[model samples]
Target chain A: MKFMNNVYQVITVAKKEYIDALKNRVFIIFVSFLLILTFVSIIVSSFDFQAKVISYQTALAELQASHQIIQNLTAPEFYPLQLLRGTIEYIEIIGAILAIVLGYLSIAKEKGNNTLQLLFTRPISKIKLFFGKFLGNVLLLTSVSGFMFFGIYLIISLIGKTVITNIEIEKIFLSFIFSIIYLSTFFSISALLALIFKSLSNSLILSFVIWIVFVLVIPQIGDTLDPDNQVPGGLFNKIGITQKSDQLTILKDFSSYEKARDSLEQSSFTKHYERLIFALLGIKDMYNGKTINFIINDKNSDILWLVSAMILSSTLTSIIFTKKKLINK
Target chain B: MNKIFYIAKEEIKILFREKIFFTLLGVFVVMSLISSFLGFMATNTTTSIYNSSVKFLIQKGINNIPPNPMLSFGALTDFRNIIIYMFLIGALLAVVIGHRSFIRERKSGVLPILFSRPISSNTLFFGKALGIGITIFSIILSAFLIGILSSLLLPYRHLLFDDILRLIIFYIFSFFYLLFFGFVGLLFAIKTKSESLALFIPICIWVGISFVLPEIISGQNPTALLNPIAMGQVQVQNSVFFSLMQTYLQPFSIGGQYTSFALQLINNTSQTSLINVILNNLSNITTLFISIIGTSTLCIYSINKNNIGKDEIYE
Candidate 1:
């Protein structure tokens, strides 16, 4: 009875947030920008792949006309989902910023307009209101991810003239859910910061600083510090350790460095989200032909980290909004 | 000019007093302290691994081995990560500084009072712009001194006079590069009607400049920029669209120009003479000048057009 009333109050608040964001000009312009970038990046990649095959065919025909052997020729190979690389990165960087903007605006507007006091006088608890905002944003990000994935599928099919497999669809769906969780973590963090700070602009700038650290700086440090990235192709490939046995033999000597790099990457939810999504999309070669379950099993730790971070952040935001005297702060 | 100097000095003081600005300055200082060390650490780890591989090969009775290639690389080249750090964090910090320059005045209701003085809008605008320029220069100088200290303090590596000259040149260009973003922040701050939008628009523009344009030119995804070994720029580097993008947009790619400019001289990745490196970055110098002049022109024009009666704006 009372629980249902509380749920109703949360839903009402969430509905208002959704409508507010939907009407925002900044959000609209940014979503359009990301979609356009996705379209351009994927088309370029598709045509680049097609050009390779066309050139191969042209060479094969010339060889036949000149009475030359074509026995050793081979066509370029690639997975279709690999073209989603740009889309993934767009979501990681721009999408995260959009979430921050949403979160900042969420609390900033209430405080700016002095609606926080009015809302507090209402029949809703602060925790329910916080959860309501979280749910509203989670729904919005999910819709964006769904729209983006659908756009990617249409682009690949219409442009590349290929069919997406059922397994591929499942991978996209799983990636979609994790993408929401990743975005929601950022959303909650920014919301908490906006609630904590007295000045909205400073809090907004601080949220951006946190975004830069988690999204760009930490992951980049981990990548640059990687010993394998020292060479052009890779250290392992350059030094004749292509064989799995030999590679394992060599890696035994660098376990400490590798562990340090892994632990550093583990600290960033962006990296975990990236790892999980890239595996699901078959962007990494080792997982290209692997089953969805196998990829899920292999990337279980990243999956857990992303989910846990999202839940923890949301819980923390709720607790702070409830326990602290932050509403009027 | 004296009034301009006075106003510029005040603007700098106001920026230094901001807590958020101080926080980012601390991050920039810490990164600068570790920039050269991280570069050296990467080289050390790579060389150590290569040596181990060589020993393994020799034990297996292999005939020949390759020498350590990283040893031949220049000392300044190890500072590549620092260049990227400036591009990311330094640019954002500059934007915040610029946004605050005008927005702070507007929030505090000082535009009318300032206009009532003998100072013209041009004087005030130039004063603020000069203030931003000096602030960026001071930050870069601190990083420069830190670079020198790191180079001197490290034992395994040494920087020659030429290496120091290259660092100086790179930091000089970096100052202009960061100032352009500051100008962007100023332009939008002066023009935009909303407070959050003022900060928001400049960041979007920064993303387009630093990430999207280069991605379009290279036809490589942003992921490749992060971890290169996973997916490289091999396939699209040969496309017609890639060629066209290079000829047209690559010259004006603000971030790309800065990156290649630094990489050519400091990283020595191009293996060219210093004069050749400068000639290669001719586009960088021209476009950076154009960006600075154009943005300042708009900022100056916008300042004159500012609504004097408007004290505060929508969020």
Candidate 2:
């Protein structure tokens, strides 16, 4: 009975917040941007689509010129839609910012508008009030995201485009899932901020700071912790180190070493981490079974841990903020 | 000045009183600590291992290569570049500060109370601005000091002092960018009496100016922009109008060829050479000054027109 009451109260609060948000020009602009971005992504992904085709053509030409066999050159079943994966990622980033802004504003706006005091006067529980606001914003985002998706899908379908594949749809769904997780974190941060900081702006700053650390800093720090992409010795270690006979030319030969170094230099950390993680997890066997064996167990465990931690934090933040007193600013 | 000081002091006091700031600070420090430990272990282990690998490679035949210490743990060059890009992320904080100032006061009934006093509108505006500026600066400075100290004190000793300097410079640049955004945010805060308007306007501007504008300038393609991170760069383009404005504002002769190959994919490749030449020849200081002035002027206008709770306060 209590839970239902809480839910109803939250729903009521959320309805009011949602209406307020819809009338807000900023939210409208954000939704507009998302719509535009969805279309823009269609355009951007098309470029990638073109680039990949060109790259394949160039590869074919090079192989043919060199008298090498260009075998199995058929476009993979998922070929056309692969760029959609990138589009989804771009969307997730946009979604992250949106979640932070909306969530932060939803709570902070009450105080800034001098409406929080009035809100507290309503016979609703704080939990309902807090969760209601977050869910309301989430519903709004879902609507906007759904609209964008529908619009894009319609345009593509109408155009009789061959690029929309089930695989691409799957990737888009995966991206949407990830966006939910990302958005939840931002939402929790917003609630936490709204409770902790009396001023809407300061709360926003805190939310923004949280986003920076999670999205930018931690990822970098994670990569910078891995071992495979390290620089060579400090000259002292080079003194006694001997070259092994079976080493690849790229690793051993002087000219090849420069090329290797250049290749390594140009590569992104994500790529480096992927390679190392794959090898460590023994997933390299999936690509090549012999000669290289990765012995480590539970490779995906860290990802699980990260996901769990994020969920835990979000839950804890909600619990903490829900019980806190509503200050009438 | 007194009003400014009082407001700033109040801002700082509230920051300390609030759990959010402490929570965030704790989060940052803990994250930094963990990262430092991981960086140390990863860099130390990889450097030792890679040192041997490099020796083996070189002893067999490797030549004409420069050793990049940046790869001690990972090829951190891109990661480092992203970290630099993240500095611009502080713009969000500035936006929040600016958006909240008058917007919050009005929400809390503080605006009318303050106006009831003998303070001039300019002083009121300045006080709020100064309060936000000081608060932002203090938080940023603390974060910078912590980040640099952690990097230097980390066990691996892999990070160079210069790297720390780069981080500091980036922090300072971040602060300036924050101020730039802060002023703009303040303008928006003052323009709209609505609470949602204050919160959302700055974010939308950030998304538009910092994200979408660059996207448009890059010709709707991902590859066209030379360093995507340059969007965060405080430097404005060397447009003639911008240059003229900058020349009138700052004493420094700024501007140089700004053609970065990273942006090639974003621009028409053929004109890149010419663009490079033009950018090199133009004075950058002029453009930067103009943009700052434009933002500041907008803030001034917003503050001047802001008349929230006026009748209530005067009566």
Candidate 3:
């Protein structure tokens, strides 16, 4: 019965928030703005797609023709990873500002207007109220994201462009998931700040500063502070002690066919031990000085998701802070 | 004139009363100083390395075009990006200020008392917006000046008078953009009677316009300024798709190709010739136009019809 009541309270609060937000003229304008922006983006992106296709076709033809003239000429290297990384970084920076602003303002404004106290005075527990607000914000976020996706789809269909293939869809999905994780993290941070600062504007600025530190400053700091793992022989060097030793030992041991035969015929305990030692020591160094890399080839993206869950735990910590007496502060 | 000044003065005073406004200004000042110092130090180190490279090139009788003048200040090519960031910060600051400006007065039960006086609703609205706008403008200007001054006094020293003027112009536009949204925020705060909506509304607009909307419709690809051969303008770059607008956004494809007897096309770069840099600077102007006109229209309309004396507890 207690669990049901808790769930019920959370749902009721969420419903009220949703209804109130829907009735807000500001919310309506923002929704309209989102829809309009999505529409415009689609048209613009389609034009870009058409241009890319033409360029790609021309480049491919040029490459093939050049291959006939210079048989050994290799195609220029393309940096898809760099491009993907840059795009994701660019979008993340933009999204962080939006998330921080929204998250801080949502709680800060409520507190500023004293509506938060009224909302808290309800029969519901603080946890329920927190969750309800969070859920409501999530819904708003989803609506905006959905509008953007739909607009993009329409644009691709209108342009008859096949740029958004299955691979592109998957990449988009991953990027969106990463964005949501970051968004939730920002929300948690903002909520905590709102509770601590008591003013929307302060919370907004503080959250923004934190966001900048995390999104821009931290990565740069990480790069500069971490020492590069330089190899002894350098990147291109192929000198190998094991290879040299193995070659020398093999050459010395098998200098002649008769010597080799004599060595093979020796079945004594010492000969067996020697052979064992040699076999243990004789390792190939095909890659020479190349560093052994450990790649995470896990079948599941569970770790990435676990990060989001961990962030949620941090958000739960803010509830403890929220449960503290705000009026007294 | 007195009425406008009266409104502006009232607005400014109210903003001063808000603790957050002062805190933000203080923090912004500190951050500006830190970023400026760090940026200057980092750029100086890089400039020395580049100077040596220039000397080496000259010694080899290879004269490259002089480094762009604004490079010393990180304002050469990155000025566009800096402007965008400044505009975003300005808009956000305005929204936060606007969100609470009129709403706070009503929440404090002062609006009714103020309304009972000889003050008109328009004056009240104007006053509230002006106050917040002034504060936002001050913070942005101060931050830009600090950043510029720090950049100028760096060890490498390449800051020109033109750079400072350009930055000032950029800062002005930044405030203008923010003021446009600040007024809209004023409308939201007044009409919704829910400060939460005011803050959330502007954020959603910013996100939608800058990220979600742009990414969905056009991906990351910006429109090219001109065709590769510098002949004419094009809607998009032929080579790079979804790249941020930069010098490299043009099509890299050298013209001319060879075809085999079997009708297989091969890239024949042997016959390809170098082309001059062709780009259009108009797309950026178009973007500015859209943002200015769209946001201003909403602000002007909302303020014009706003019911400033409404009860505070609407939600």
Candidate 4:
């Protein structure tokens, strides 16, 4: 009976939160940006494909005109699914920012308006309130992701004139699910910070600083440590360390550096999220055309990291929200 | 002039007091130091690699050794990472400075008080601009000082007067590039009703200018999007569509031009006189100059047009 009552309270609060978010102009703008960028990515990627094909054809024509024996002149394969590459990058940057803004606004608005005190006067426990907000946000994020995936599906099939496999659809769906978890980590952190900081603006500023560290600094640090990230191709490739065995042999010489780089990468949830999504979406050529099972199996650790981050951040948020005197600055 | 200086001084004081600004300043300094150290390490590693290779060739009785690429000024291109970091983080920092200049005043209910003062709108605008300009310059200068010190500590390469001059020029370009964004943020802050929206809109523009435009222009080559040195290495097959896009996008790509100009100075890969390199890239230089001037003019206009008492404050 108590559990049922708590659930009822949570649902009521969640519905209110959902309605408020829907009415928010900032939220609306972010969603619009995401959707618009999704379409733009598809269009831009298609043009990119066309350009590559044209360049290849031109090269082939030149070779034939000279009557030269042609080798390695195969036409580029058009992977309609590859159009999702830009979408992932957009999500990494814009989607993460949206999550941060939504999370910040959700708590900061309540705090700023002195509504938290009124809300506390209700029968709902603080945990229930926090859960309600989290659930509402999760639902909202889910809908956004659902719309994103469906739009990509429609654009790829209808506009791009390419058919996606059922399995490919499933993989895309799974990637979005992971994205939700990844994004929720940011949301939970922002919400937690909003609850902690006295000034709402300070909370928002700190959130952005944290965002820069995780989104830009940490990953780039890892990239810098790995000589491969210094150049266009992997540095190893540039230095004639091409073969897998040869690369490993050389890596052994710099195992300490590799270990340090790995640790730095491990600290960032973005790295985990990127690793999983990049594999699932075949952003890297090695993962291209691979089955979802194969990709997931290869990236099991990254998936685990992302899930752990989501769970850890949300749990921490709930605990902090319940234990802290949120109204007393 | 005295009133402007007073306002500017007060602005600087408030900026230093803000924890967010202080934190960003610290991060920028640390990043600069790290970038310079990394450049030093890269140079050292390359030198060692060349030495070992030469030793091995001598043992094999090979007489002629290829010149080490690391010995040239091109090796200083490792410091190009600093330019990339500045491009990525500079605009965001400027947004903060810009917000503090205009939006925060409105939020704190200080704008109305300022508006009632005897000072004209032009003076107020100039004062705020001057304050922001000095603050940004100081932050960059701090980073420059740290970078130079860190680089000097590493004895891998002898520091030349010419190299020091080039570094100073690069930072100057960086200052203008960052100032342009600061003015842009100020422009948006004055225009927008919502404080968060003011911040968000400028950042969105930053994203477009720094990331999206470059990505579109340099398709299939992500490195070129951030690193002008990498862009220099890219060989784009000519297409009318691409040409049109490049022409349209070039003016907006202040970050790219900054990167290119800085890399050209530090790397000197063209192996030409500095004046010739500057002359050859006159168009890029002019674009940066025009952008700074244009954005400053717009920012001033926005400040003048905005009525502190009339504007809605969305807190």
Candidate 5:
């Protein structure tokens, strides 16, 4: 009965978080803007402007999907899941900010209103209350992922005029689930900082600083470090290293340089999430047409790293929020 | 005027004491210091990879090896990544500085109290704006020096007079471009009822400016642009929609313009005089100037319109 009561408290708090985020007009507006932009970009990708601005990848997908022939472009089969590559990039950049804001507000508001102390005085223990808040965050994030899923589904069906295959749906579902994990890790980092710091503004600034480093800086460093990125089409392609075997053979001589580049990306969870999502979405050329199981098996370590980051950061957040001096102001 | 200067001086002092601001400033400096070295490394690694690829081809009995791509590269090529770093880090630091400037007074519940004094709202705005302008200038200048010093550290290269002039113009462009974001941060900070929203809205704009607009214009995946090679990929489609977008929205794509201009100035081989370069980019220069002026007007207007007596309804 006691365990059930604890679960009940967690659910109540979780529901409040979900509702609170919904009620916040700014959050709603931003979320809607993000969804609408993603959908519009996917839907109208064939028009010259959309093709030029929305992402050429989407334009390519459109050509491939509609079975239109453009010379110098050839694909044996079209992978519909690849359309969500732009969506994933949006989620990586804008979605991460949304998560950070959600995490900061999850506790910052309670402390700001001076209700945290009062809430702790109630029958529920600090640990349970903290868990409730975390649960609330989880619910809110799941709802966001749900909306993103619908937007992608709407595009594939409405635009492509083809129902998603079960396997395609499954791959997309897994991709979004990983997105939640990626976003939740950022949320935990924001919440942990908001909990630990006395100055909420300072905490928020630091969160953004961390966000820029991971989302923009590190991934970019990894890209610029790649020798293949040196030419217009690709440096390797320029030199007839079209085959993976040839590419790897050449890279073997510069193993340490390659390792350093990989290590830089590995240090940031965004890269792990991106690699996993890109593979699942078949956005990566090598991963296209590969089976879901094969892709997952190949990218399992990314899954592990992503999940571990979410768990570790969340644990740290919970521990920090329960400190003796939870809120000074 | 004396009082405004006093307010500006105090603003600078307080900004220096903020640990988060200092830490970010340090990051901007460090990134500026290493940007050229990283570019140099990118060239070295690519050349080395090319050499190995040639050797591998000879081993496979394939003899028609391509000439070295890096042969065409100038010392200016080593500074390519600075364009990206400016887009990624430089604009963001500006936003933070702007947000922190006003958010602090509002958060401390002191804005109303400041208004109660014998000071005009416009006076306060200018004071703060001047302080912010100087602060941003100082940061940009420091980054400029760091960039030059790092270039000096590049192995086996000499930066010519035009290279130095281009770097100067690039930093000048960066200062104004970043200042626009600074004003964006200030305007939202004053207008928004919630602290997080104040920050969130501006960052969303940053994302749009930095990544989204360029993606739309270039039709490249946002990530693909990070690869220096993709920077030069032309997205030329002569269609009504594409032409319309280029005509109207392209001017507002200041970040995209900045990136292209930065690459031209820093990375690409151009021997034009500084005057011609400036004249050629008159559209972008005017757009940036207009944007900064417009944003600062709105920022000051928001401050005057703000009811300083009431505490901010922060979430």
Candidate 6:
């Protein structure tokens, strides 16, 4: 009976939190932006594919007219999965910010309104209350990610005119699962910060600073450290250093710098999440058309890092909220 | 005029008292130094590699080693990252400054008192603008000084007077570019009802200007997305949309324009006066000027029309 009651209380709180999140204008705006951006990315990728197809068809037509050998004129392979590349980038940037905002609003609103005291006066324990809020947000994030995945699926199947195989659907599902985990880590961090700081604005500002550092600054630092990352298509590739081993050989000359860059990149959960998703969704050119088994096997460490980050951040948030004082005044 | 100065002085004082302000300022300074330093390191590495390759080629009896690209005026391209940083973090800092200058005052109910002091809204607006101008100027000046000091650490190259002059010119352009963003923030702060939304609107604008438009303009050309230097190397058969982006969108992209102008100045490719460069890119210059003036006018107009005492009077 007690266990059932606890579950019921958690559900009740979760529902309240979900309703509150829906009413938030900022959250609404962010969700709209995410959806719009995702849609736009799909459209843009389709246009890009169309342009390539037209050029390929034109070349093929000219070759046939000129009586050239048609053996070398292979048709362009349509990798509809490549459209997810832009979606992933948009998710990386916008999804993370949305998580932060949702996390902030979840606790900061209660604290600002002194409703935490009222909640503490309830029969439920603080641990349960915290879990309820977390559960609520998890459901909300899942819904958001699910909506995005469905949108992507519709665009790919309807617009790209591609057959959605079971394997492709599985990959999309797995990517959404990973996105939820990746975004939950940020949500946990933001919630923890909100709980720690008395002032809502301070917490929000600190969260943004941390977000900027992790999301923008760290990856940029790593890119800057490697001369190859400064240029598009890899600087070495531009200069005829096409082989991966040759690139590594050149990079080995700057081992100390590489070590620093690697360390900085490892410190950011954003990098780990990006690495895993890029591999899983075939966002990177090298990863395109790779099987799920190949991605999992090759990117095992990235998967480990992402899961670890999500666990660590969520655990920290739970502990902090349960132990910390509820009232500021 | 004296009243405006007093208001400006008070605004500056309030800005310095906030911990967030100092933290942001520190971030800007440190990031500027680090970006400039990394740029120097990247150039030095390239130069060393070039020298060693040339030596090996000469030893192999191939005497006609091509001139090292890193040793030319293009070495100044290293500082392009600083301009990029100005567009990203520098714009956010401006938003913060602009928010604190106007939005915070309105939120704290201090604006009515200030308005009651017999000062016209135009004078007050100018004062706030002047205060923000001074604060941003100081930040940029420090960045310039630190940039110069850090550049001296690059072992392979010596600073030329021409390089220094170009750097100064770039910093001047950066100041105006950042000021325009600040005014944009102020415009939103005055226009929006919610304070958080006010701040968020500016960030949305930043992302749109800095990322989205450029991505659309540089479709399929990955290099042109981030680095303006790579835009020069892109060879595309222009479609109608592409042509439209180049002609219309390119002029309004203040960040791209500033970056391109800075790159030209630092590379010394034109060897012409800054005025000539401005004339050459008249459309871009006009767009930038119009943006600055339009935003300032809107900000002043918003402040003048709105009742400063009412909290519910914003959009």
Reported per model, the fraction of native interface contacts reproduced equals 0.50, 0.24, 0.12, 0.09, 0.54, 0.07
By DockQ, the best candidate is 1
Q: Which is the winner by TM-score between candidate 3 and candidate 5? A: 5
True-vs-predicted CA distance for residue A185, candidate 5, Å: 1.1
**TM of each candidate vs. truth:** 0.95, 0.62, 0.58, 0.92, 0.93, 0.90
For model 4, which pairs clash? none
Model 6 accuracy (lDDT, Cα): 0.76
Over A97-212, each residue of candidate 3 has an lDDT whose tens digit, in order, gives 44554465466557655776776577766677778777776665555555555455545445444445454454344444444555565656766777777455466657765654
lDDT of 5 by residue, A1-329 (tens): 98899899988888888888788866786787678757744543444333444455656788889998766653334456766677788788778888888888886888788987777677877788788888888778888888888778876878787778888888888987898899899889998988888878789889988998998889988888777776667788887778988798778878999899999999999999999999988889898878999999999999999999999999998887776577465
Q: What is the TM-score of chain B alone in each candidate?
A: 0.95, 0.64, 0.64, 0.90, 0.92, 0.88
lDDT of 3 at B93: 62
Candidate that beats the other on DockQ, 3 or 6, i.e. the better one: 6
Reference-based lDDT, residue B263, model 1: 70
- The DockQ scores of all candidates, in the order shown, are 0.55, 0.17, 0.08, 0.35, 0.53, 0.31
Residue-by-residue lDDT tens digits, candidate 4, B105-224 = 877787778878898878887898899999989988987787677766766554577667777877887888888888888888788888777777778778777767666665533323
| Whole-model Cα lDDT of every candidate shown, in order | 0.84, 0.52, 0.48, 0.77, 0.81, 0.76
Best candidate, lDDT: 1
Ranked by lDDT, the better of candidates 1 and 2 is: 1
Task: Give the per-residue lDDT digits (tens) of candidate 4, residues A1-329.
Answer: 98899899899888888899899888998899888877777776777778888988898999999998679688888877777888887887788888988898888778767888888787778888888999999888888888998899998988877878888888788988998998898899889888888777677777888888887777766665455544445444444435776556545655675687789888988988988888887777799889988998999999888899899988988998889887764
Query: Model 3: which docking level applies?
Result: incorrect
lDDT of 6 by residue, B125-147 (tens): 99999998998898889989988
Clash pairs of candidate 1? none
Interface RMSD of each: 2.6, 9.5, 13.2, 3.6, 3.5, 4.1
Order by TM-score, highest first: 1, 5, 4, 6, 2, 3
